[model samples]
Target chain A: MISRLRTALIYVVLGLGALVMVAPFLWMFTTSFRPVAEAFTLPPRWLPGLDSSLESYRRLLASDVPIGRFFWNSTVLATTVTLGYVATTTIAGYAFARLRFPFKNALFALLLVSLMVPIQTTLVPLFLLMRWLGLVDSQWSIIVPGLTGAFAPGMSGVFGIFLMRQFFLTLPKELFEAARVDNAGHFRTFWSIAVPLAGPQIAALSVIIFTMTWNDYFMPLIFLNSVDQMVLPVGIMSIRDPVGNSSATSEVIAAVSLSILPVLLVFLVAQRWIIDSFVRAGVKG
Target chain B: MTSIANDAAAGWFSPQNRKETIAGLLFIAPALIGFAVFVAGPMAATVVLSLMKYDLFSNPSFVGLANFEAMLDDRRLWKVLGNTAFFAVFAVAGNVGLGVVLAVLLNRNMSKTVQYAYRAAYFFPSLVGLIFVAVIWQFLFQRDIGVINYYLGLVGIEPVRWLSSARNALWSVIILDIWKNVGFAMLIATAGLQSISKDYYDAARVDGSSSLRTFWQITLPLLSPTILFLLTMNTIGAFKVFESIVVLTNGGPGDASRSLVMYIYEQGFKSFNMGYASAISLLLLTITVIVTAIQFALSKRWAFYE
Candidate 1:
């Protein structure tokens, strides 16, 4: 009876923590759907009525913010970067995992050490490089860096390689040995043997990279000043400040909510894999 | 590093090593190029740029250690650094503390479905951009209209200034960070908990030791490595934070919530003090590296590996 009571108390605590975590999203959606007046009330309504209107959504669509342009730019930039990581990280990771290389340990150490450098160190020179290349306002600037781990080469890319190396180290050696016995070249061996079996880890890598690239605001904010190239987060910034102005509360909330809808949907579906991947990564180290 | 030794022992290096080296080089070529261009090249230039004064107008003249000396007198630098440092320590503490609690809670006997539901709830917010969180939180943190204040009013407590006030601003950012990140730390902790052998629990039960005693003695020591990982990652992640606070407060009430990164952005881009900004960023980098080294050295005293 005492153990059962303890279990119930644990559930209650977990439930309350969950409530705190979900509150912002709940407030965002419910407040967005409410009428402009109630949305701005001194003490919020907390729950919107069934009479909640689609008025804020309509306003966001009708606004002069060029929402579609931002959406396209974000989609293209994120998609390109995600694909780039999938290819670059997969090969590089596989090489580090399976292939013999000169100065391999030393090289990997350099990558790991670079991870400690803060992103601020790179921003100044990255901007200078972009200006020199005449790609200051171009999407290419974001995409190129995005492919290089989106923040620091020391971070995302190196992380992917580390994960892959750990994973590959676990596989039966006889499998790769068989490929070598077939007189297979390194590329062929990787393509035929390693790539085919690494579907799950690669998928996890893809999903994580895509989510990261999509959610990135800082790099895009720095590189692309043109509205036509602005991504969702920065575009949302330009649309409304969402603070201090009670009048625009509903519309601003609606826009921000809409901005996250695609990623939210993606997360809902991919969350199991995401959770499992984190668990797996943590378990290893 | 152990993995490399393992690979070498596994005969990844053999009579055919020369051929493998060429293939390996070709495979890693793109990553090498990326490193050279993005991190290595920029790092080199950043160091050089830190020593020169160029405002995107004329040739950069070498200014010796003027930029580094300038940081000593820069009041805003000291303020933002303080805020970032405070956030780093406390934000990591909040996340790790809550994470350990949640991990322990979830470890209690429960239906898998319920456990999953609880996890999804905690983790859902982290999926979207911090931009979205900031926007939603802007209203939720509103002084008068916010639900937080409304709830406080119901308890007969006054509505607190969460973002607007200098005193509360950095704390509010820290709160936002803990909320956003505790899910990740919880996930890592859960993994760590699961990896702890069930034999430990069984033996403790056999010895008639209470659950609390077992947790303190076995669980925490076993969790030290994971906790160390969280501390290091969260500290680094905290220093990198920019957009969420930028959207929420823009370092308002006079640099009360500005991070080192935000300060760097303002100096380099807005104020056009690129050289000084570069020097400050190196300082930020130095502080982070030192803190991480200290964490690692400290971990040697208590971290359990088995």
Candidate 2:
């Protein structure tokens, strides 16, 4: 009886925790469907009724804020950066894992140490470098740095390299030796043997990099200033009237909901892989 | 003549060695070049820039530690530092504590479906961008119309000014941060808990050890390394809190919610004090490194592997 009671208690606790976690998102979803006056109603309706309208969403889509353009820019930037990161890390990881060269260890060590430096330390100089290149207001300012792996400590391509290197190290050396005996060059061996076997790691890295670049706010905020050039996060921030007279709460809520839908959908689809990757990374370390 | 002969005989310049070197270098070239330009070069320049006064419009004049000296008297710097430290402490504690509790609850003898559902629910918040988080939480904390205050009214508590008041704004941001991040900590802790051999629990049960005692003796000690990892990462992340502040309060109610990183942005971009901003950034970098080093040193006492 006591054991059964304890089990019931655990379920109750878990259920309550889940409620706390899910309620706000539920509220946001409902409010997006609500009219402006209904959204701010004193009773705080949890569900939209007959008064709920799609007008807020329509207004959000039609607003002069250029929401679609921002979305496109963010998509292109994130996809390009993810591809670039995967390519750079895979090759660098392979080199670090399999190749023998002078200063290899030293260079790897430098990369690891660079992970400790804060992004704030690099912001000013990177901005200046962008200016020097005449790319300050261009999307290239964001894309170039992102593709080149100029990321913050935990979010950097160095972490990706580390993950891939660890994965590559677990592969058998005989595979590479077989390729070399077949008169294969290093590139051929990597492309044929190593790349084919890296499916899981590539999926893991791609999802992670895509998510990181998509949700990134600081880099885009600093680099791209024009309203039309803004990414989603910055663009969302731009929608607010600075003088505080805006009564578009419902519209803003709609915008927020729409902005996160892509990532939310991606997370819903690839959540298993994402969680598995994090678990493997943590447990192995 | 002898050296030349030896060099030729050593095979250092042989085709095989040359091929290996070239391939290796080529493979790493993209990352190396990117790192040198975008990361390393900027890092070196920050050190130089911190020592000089530059305003983007003017040729930078050598200031020779004036920026660092100015930080001594800058009250805003001190305030933001205190705010950041306060945030890190509360946010890290809340995240780790709640994460452990949630992990423990899920790790218990639950159905697989139940476990996955609860995990997904908790993790959903982390998927949204910080901007959305800020916006959603802002509406929730709205004074008269918010769901939070509505519930508070039901419980006969007064509606608190969550973001408008100076005292509560920082804590509001901290709460939202904890809400968004605790799932990550929970995931790490769950992994840690799952990895422990079931034999430890079995032996403890055989020895008539109570569940609480087993948790204290077996679970926490075994999970210390994962906890340490979460601690270091969480501390670094909390120190760099910027987006939530920008989106939620914009350092409002007279700078009560401003973080160190946000302050750096204001100085560098808003005030155009690039030199001083670099100095403050270096301070942030120094603090992060020191905090991480301290965590590493302290981890030896508790974190166990094998």
Candidate 3:
């Protein structure tokens, strides 16, 4: 009886915590479907009315704000960056793990050291470099720096390299030895053997990089200047100036709801791999 | 005879070694080039830029120590730094404390479905964009019509201006930050708890130890490393808080919530004080490095490995 009581208590606590975690998102969704006046009601209506207004979403879609363009820009940018990061990090990680090269450890150490340098320190110089290349206000400014993986500490090339290298290091050396004995070169061995076997890591890395790039606000805010070039996060903020002006409140809520859908969908589809990656990374550390 | 023949075939300059070396270099070239141009080069330029006074349009002239000197007398610099420190302390403590509690509660004796559901719900906010997070919380924090104030009014409390008041703005951002990030700490703490062998708990039970005693003596010691890891990471992240502030307050009614990174952005991009911004950036870099080093050093005293 006591054991059963304890179990029930645990469930109650867990349920309440989960509600707190989920309330903001639920509120955002309901408010997106609420009319402006209803949103501002005194008691704060929690339920959508029978009519279920779509005016906010309609205005968001019909406006001259180029919501569709912003979505397209973010999607394309994130996809390109994810693909590029996988290719670069995989090759580099494999080389570091499996092959002997001159000054390899030193170079790898340099990469690790660079990870500690905050992005703010490098922001000015990088911006100047972009301006010199005449890439400011263009998607290339975001994409080019992103290609390097040094744009942010968390999603940088160094982090990906470390993750991939750690994954590759655990593989049996016999596999590579056998491939070498069969007269396979390094590239051939990597593509034929390593690449085929890296399904889980690739999936995890892709999801991580995709979400990071998609949700990125700082880089795009700094680099992209025009409406056509702005990403979703920045574009959403642009639509609702200074946050809570009653006129755009519902519209901004609608936009926020829309902005999170892609990431939420991706999370639902890949929750296992995504959650597992965080756990594994934490345990490894 | 075979060994002799193999030795003869593999000379000082072997084809296999040469091929592997060339392939490795080619494979790592993109990463190396990227590091050089983007990270290393920029890092070097930041130091030089800090020493020169150059706006984007004009030639950068040497201005030795002026920017650094100006930083000392800059009154707003102290305010921003204080705000950043205040934010880092509360945010890190709340996230680490709450994360450990949640992980302990959900670590055992739950159905698989319930476990997954709780994990998903907790982690959902972290996956959303910071801008969206800021917007959602902004709506909920509106003094007149927000859900929070509405609830407070029911309980006979006055409506608090969450983002408008100077004193409340910083705390509001901190609360939003804690809400968004506690899940991450939970995930990390959960991983740590799961890794603790069941044998330890079994041993404690055999000794007839109470649950509280077992947690204090066994679970906490075992979980210290994870706690330390979360502490360091959360501190670094909190110090660099930008997106939430930008979207919600933008340094606010009187610069009450401007973070170091935001100030750097304002100075460099808005005021065109490139030299001053670079100096401030270096200061931020120094603080981050020193704080991280201190945490690692302190972890030695408490974090258990075996």
Error of 3 at B166 (Å): 1.7
- What DockQ values do the models have? 0.62, 0.59, 0.66
Candidate 2 chain A: 10-residue stretch with minimal lDDT: A240-249
Q: Considering TM-score, which of the candidate structures 1 and 3 is the better prediction for this target? A: 3
For residues B11-101, what per-residue lDDT tens digits would candidate 1 score against the true structure?
Answer: 5456545568778998888877887787788888889989989787778889999998999999988998888889888999999989887
TM-score of predicted structure 2: 0.95
lDDT accuracy of residue B245 in candidate 1: 87
Model 1 ranges with Cα > 4 A deviation:
A42-48, A148-155, A242-247, B1-18
* TM-scores of all predicted structures: 0.94, 0.95, 0.95
* Superior candidate under DockQ, 1 versus 2: 1
| Candidate 1 lDDT, A90-170, residue by residue in tens | 788788777777788888888776667665777898899999988889998877865765342224567777777777777
Instruction: Order the candidate numbers by lDDT, best to worst.
Output: 3, 2, 1
lDDT of 2 at B192: 94
Clashing residue pairs in candidate 2 are none
Which prediction has more favorable DockQ, 2 or 3?
3
Clashes of 1: 0
Model 2 lDDT tens row, B254-281: 9898999999999999999999999998
- The reply for model 3, stretches above 4 Å from the true place, is A1-3, A47-49, A152-154, A243-247, B1-14
**Per-prediction TM-score of chain B?**
0.92, 0.94, 0.94
